[model samples]
Target: MNYSHTTLTGDEGPQQQVTMFLTRHTKTTANAIDLIQGWSDFPLTQEGIEIARQFGRGLQGTRFAAAYCGTLTRHYETARIALDNSGNDNVEIRFEPGLREYNFGSFEGRDVSTTHQAVAEWLGYSTVEEARAARGPKFDLDVQDALYALDAENMLHTDLVPQDRAESADMVKQRMWQAMTNIGDLVSREGGGNVLVISSGTAIRQFLWTIDSEVDLTYLGNTAVTKVDYDKGTFSIEQPVGSMAYYERGAQ
Candidate 1:
């Protein structure tokens, strides 16, 4: 239950099995500023740099069989810093584009607070949730309200990030599942070993979604790692790494 030990090097070996250590990227300046960063490439803040170093140091002795990261600088830099600090400079870090974040089209780099206000005003709703609620039962929606929701959803996700592109949680889930399948293949081909994957909070939430369909992305611990073990067609979750909750497949 002591998941916050700050050391993972002890969980490595040539043990005829594959183990994945999934970590979220460190904090960013955009995060500190309450911006809807989405796929926008933001450089790491000074604290983010230090956090990466500390994370790497914590895993110093765990020699990874392979490492994976996304194309984003946030993910790449976090992995590089962690790997470099952990003396894993020799590990071939594989970059996979499929692991990128959900594109937050029109909202990229915009202040979430202001964006919410604008959305609320545009939809004739006092709040963003009111807008969403109106889109469902109990509240009547007008033609413009529907269009605003469509635009807002687009602004939440997309690669080119159109002026009015929004992404549903389900959309993110699909891509993340695809990435997992990709990682599973990579592990299977490598004959099983330890892996260190560096990705963003959104992608990480998708991974959590892969296991728990009811998981809320907003509630996931950003800096926490999630350890997953897969073998013999079975998957077991080891809670949120650094947290006291260690969950296995269903009830005992």
Candidate 2:
């Protein structure tokens, strides 16, 4: 919710504007196997395809000004599917490098159960379960949360030029915030309007966490939408995680 007050010629007065929709790319094959997928570029599962399509159908009547997608195939492909299904094929899907998922480095494509142990040890926790529990009772083998936990401490290897090491949580937020700021600048300079941002759940969760520590991210399901408004100077979460209810499909 970015805002600035300005006078109108008539009595209409100033109004707030600037809107963006953030959504997680649907499930991938890695998800089925309980593997951690960070920058691995796994293709979407069949279920993932349907999830994106349903979201698109739900958005069929809505029109977007433009779209921003990560360089990965799943990210861009999800955006494409939604845009096409939403009947907005004319909107350009820009390749946004900043929107890519966290670079998990050595942990990419590894089993979460195993990596949790490794990360826990790396972070000096007795066990990954202990570290996961430290975050809160609800947090499980969530790879995103685990990474954020490590990054919260000084354990992660950041400040590297090439960033071959695991990307810090702060870095992920910076990247997403940059993407939002760029879009916000575009909208502000060119007249504000709605924009679609296709990203991953882990990344989106980190962005939300960066903004508000009280945000509850436990039940955020596939293709869930988080509405945010932004200006060049600030980005605001209009709707927090799991704000949009998914289209119902039974017994899949």
Candidate 3:
């Protein structure tokens, strides 16, 4: 559980800096099922392998000091396969507990919709009826409303939930902050080189929030990669790193 770190590559000097390519793990069974996967270690689906291959194509020419991933099999396997396809044997893979997905306690490995429904019912509300009404054509209720309703319903179960099991959004943020700080310290102390981070979507979004609070984390597309520049103690968000527009198509 010692997930703290300092550097990934190069020597420490005045010219040293770190540029990170933040990426999420490719499609997985959890994703395909629309489940709440917090802390669950599910293997990737076949489609996930294909999606990860695409990500590897983006890293072909990009030099990395070292790469980091969570301890979960989905993340580690994706990193391994992607690096193999990229033919980048030089980049190291580091495993850290702080990089693991959010811990959701009893909610792990369960359908998100079912959990939402159960929580709503626990709160003494007829969620199915409400959902039906909300689903009416031209209702114009945004998806955010459903998310809020689900969150509120879950909150009502707070007393039934136990600590060391369920993780709140705030807790997830704090853990990610610690992990990134450790990575930053590494870059600050070790010098200049690219570092690729393979983490869960929410963890990556939390990093984005720390870098640019204005960016919408929930708005990112699936398996997206965002580039960030960190130099002289300042961080700036850049474009997605895996766009095909940047590189010619390689062998499929």
Cα lDDT tens digits for candidate 3, 1-252? 234343445545564567777677877888898888767888899988877776677568777777778888887877777777676766678876677777766566778777667644544557845754654321111222333345445643544334535655566667776776667556666666787777887666666666666664444334566777776657778865333331223333
Q: What is the TM-score of each candidate against the true structure?
A: 0.70, 0.78, 0.73
Clashes of 2: 0
**Residue 227 lDDT in model 1?**
72
Which of the numbered candidates is closest to the native, going by highest TM-score?
2
Q: Against the unseen true structure, what C-alpha lDDT does each candidate score?
A: 0.62, 0.70, 0.64
Provide the lowest-lDDT 10-residue window in model 1. Answer: 243-252
Candidate 2: clashing pairs of residues: none
Over 4 Å off, model 3: 1-15, 116-161, 219-222, 240-252
Residue clash pairs of candidate 1: 105-161, 153-166, 154-165, 154-166, 155-165, 155-166, 156-166, 157-167
Q: Which window of ten consecutive residues has the lowest lDDT sum in model 2?
A: 1-10
The best candidate by lDDT is: 2
Which candidate order results from sorting by TM-score in descending order?
2, 3, 1
Task: Show model 1 residue runs off by greater than 4 Å.
Answer: 1-16, 116-149, 152-164, 214-222, 232-234, 241-252
Candidate 2's displacement at residue 139, Å, is 6.0
Error of 1 at 40 (Å): 0.8
Predicted structure 2, TM vs. truth? 0.78
Q: Give the poorly placed runs of model 2, Cα more than 4 Å off.
A: 1-16, 121-129, 137-162, 244-246, 249-252
